[model samples]
Target: MLRRLALTAVVSLAVLSAAAPGAAAASGPLPLPSPLPLTLPLPLPQGEDDARTRLTVTVSEAGDPSAEGIFELECAPVGGDHPAAEPACDRLAELADEGTDPFAPVPRGAMCTQQFGGPATARITGTWRARHIDAVFSRADGCEISRWNNLRPVLPGVR
Candidate 1:
């Protein structure tokens, strides 16, 4: 009887351990072997002056070769700058719809470009606002991941 009890306990422990989360070995990194580069275009605010800024972003899986690309971004100031303590920038998805192409598949080993629009107003300085824009590109054949934005100011000495 003691032998049977011991055997049952061992089986139950093994079953419980296997049921635990993350119990299985991890699959290695994503299958993709290279990074995806992107670019963005910026827009200026109405009646306000703005210029295009170039941006580069590379997205790759762990243990994969880095892929890179350059793009343009446009932005303008509409609302005056807010308190430094609070982030003055917020991502506007509706703006992205104006100029940006919906996600499309890319050819393997080839690069493609797409444009996207941004918010109508962004705070540049205390009580100042600006317009914004973006452009994105990626290699063909990769999955269409989600979109992202970088609202941090690029101007020097402008916190």
Candidate 2:
């Protein structure tokens, strides 16, 4: 009887050991935290897009770094220390909605003057609706002059 019990216990132990493990489910792949391991979407669209527009606006005489004046401009209900935030934001919004290139080179088809407004240069660096902006602005030509004139409100100190 003792021998039989020992054999039966051994058999039971073997069976239990041979049994497959219980299927403990797991929630696959823990969700990544917000702003976690992210990348900006590439290959931005042409014309105006939905990219957030932020700018580090700079202006100076062409080739003169010492004279450069810079400001910050933020739009979409603009909030920044920029002096002309309200009008600037409004104008910018209008241009964007109208599909105007706020930084376009002089139009080849349009007639423009040969007058030298100045050798001033402007650079706008920031993100504009998902697109990166490192645009250079100038008053070197008719188109550039037109571009500068159109953006004067946002630029400040320009008549």
CA lDDT, every prediction?
0.31, 0.67
Candidate whose TM-score is highest: 2
Overall local distance difference test of candidate 1: 0.31
After superposing candidate 1, which stretches have Cα over 4 Å from the reference? 1-5, 16-40, 50-159
Cα-based RMSD of the predictions, in order?
16.8, 20.8
**Model 2 lDDT, full chain set:** 0.67
lDDT of 1 at 84: 20
* lDDT of model 2, residue 132: 70
Best by lDDT: 2
> In candidate 2, which residue ranges exceed 4 Å CA deviation?
1-51, 62-68, 107-112, 157-159
Q: What value does the lDDT take at residue 158 in candidate 2?
A: 44
Candidate 1 lDDT over residue span 1-159, tens digit each: 999999999999998888664444465444754554442433445665322222222222212222111112223432322222122122323223343322222336654344322221221211112332233332221232222223322211110
Model 1 TM-score relative to the real fold = 0.20
Candidate 2 per-residue lDDT, tens place, 1-159, comes to 999999999999987776634322244554643421222234346665543777888877745454367878787758776678788878876666665667655544555567776768788888766557787887766666777778767765443
